[model samples]
Target: MNISHLLRQYEQGHRDFPELNLAGVDLSKVMLISVNLTKSNLMGINFSRGFLTKSNLSQASLNWGDLTYAKMSESQLIETDLTKANLTGAFMVKSVLRSAKLSGANLSYSNLRGANLSDANCCGANLQEINLREANLTGVNFNWANLSKARLSCAVLKQASFFGSNLTDAFIKEADLSHTNLEQVNFQNSRLSYSNLQGANLQGANLQGAKLRYIDLREANLQGANLRDADLEGADLTNAIVDNADFTNATLRDTKVIGTQLKPQTIQKNLSELQLKRNPNYAGSFELLSTSYAVAVFNKDNSLSC
Candidate 1:
């Protein structure tokens, strides 16, 4: 059957539109609404501005395809291979892209609210300014990806690896980031309010000017993290290692510090000085006691306590 006939059949409520080989076809601006292209090979095809709403592209090969500005809302793309595809400004809200390979894909400015991207490989992908609110991104590999200004509010990022990635100014409010590896990631000016970051590795991360109100950092390794001027009000830092961390001018009002100890007397004193300089209303007498105790411990055991 011809492409036009198939299109008419698709628009007529025919869900199963048999295997069509549009592999190298320029299907840009085509109206493929509600079409079922399951397991089809559409690699390198240009589907820019195409209407693919409620379409099924599950297990399809769309690698290196150009889907820029395409309307693919509520589509089923489970296990689809979209590696190196350009999906910038695409509408993918509530789409199912679970376990899909989107490595090196350009998904900037895409609307992926409530999408299922769980276990998807998006390593080195460009997701800047993308909307991923309430998306299932569990175990997603976003290593070295550029996610600047992305809104991932309430997204499930459990076990996600964002090592060496740039998440600058990203809004991740109420997101589940438990056990995630965010080492060497840049979260400058990011908002992660009420997020769960339990057991997450954030070592050497730059969180300057970030707002982390009520965030759970339990057992999280934050060694060498730069948190200058960060707002950590009501945040839980239980058992979090803050060794060599820079919290200059950062707000710790109502912040939980259970099992988190200052490194040394000199360091504590310096931090206290910094804090006092930052906010004159700060009355932290415990830091002085901690310094004294650390000094005594150092003299007695010949080893500095952390």
Candidate 2:
């Protein structure tokens, strides 16, 4: 259908356009509020700077399309194919993109606050500096995606996979990442305070200088992970695996370590500092009795006592 005809129909209060083949069409800067384009073929279409608020584009193919700077707030894009699409700086606040395919897409600097991207595939996408605060990303696959400097605070990321993803300097405070797969992911200098990471797989992940205060990490795996200079104050590490993990200079003050085994290297450097504040009068030294156990020794009457 031609753009003029569509506009004329739209002016006549007709908004249903399901299965319409508008391939490579130029609809930039147009207003199409509440329009239904379900299952439409919109490949390579230009919607840049356009207003598509509350529109339904479910199952639509928008591969390699230009949606840069578009206002698609509160739109429905469920299962939409947006692979390789250009969504730079687009406003998608409160939009529903459940199970959408955005792999290889450029969503840099986009505003997706409160959007539901649950179960979406955004692997290898350019999401740098995007505003995804409070967004629902449950079970989303962000493998190899660049999310550096992104704002994802209070986002729901349960069971999500961010393998090898770059999350450096990302603001993810108070987010829920329970049971998520974050293996080898880079979270350097990220702020994740009060976040829930219970049972999450963080093996080989880089969390250097991360702020993890009051976070929940019960039963989480941190094998071979880097926690250098990271702050874990008051964080829960109950039943977590820390084998081969590096905690050099990491702040574990008031952190819970119940049922968790700390590396000898970690205990050797921080054991004295790990003592409870209530026991400040007790001077002691820790001895590695085994690979998984340590013994505290007290110097009493010029004799060592355990």
Best by lDDT: 2
Candidate 1: what lDDT?
0.82
Query: Scored by CA lDDT, what does every candidate get?
Result: 0.82, 0.88
Q: Look at candidate 1 and give me any clashing residue pairs.
A: none
Least lDDT summed over 10 consecutive residues: which range in candidate 1?
295-304
lDDT of 1 by residue, 1-306 (tens): 556776788667887864667786777998877778988889998899998999999999999999999999999999999999999999999999999999999999999999999999999999999999999998899998999999999999998889878899999999999988888899999999999999999999999999998899988999999888898777788778888887665666666565566443223335332332112232222132243223111112222222
lDDT of 2 by residue, 1-306 (tens): 889999999999999999999999999999999999999999999999999999999999999999999999999999999999999999999999999999999999999999999999999999999999999999899999999999999999988889889999999999999988889999999999999999999999999999999999999999999998898877888889889999887766656766676654653354454432222232333333244454333333322233
Model 1 ranges with Cα > 4 A deviation: 11-13, 264-306
What's the CA error at residue 30 for candidate 1, in Å? Answer: 2.0
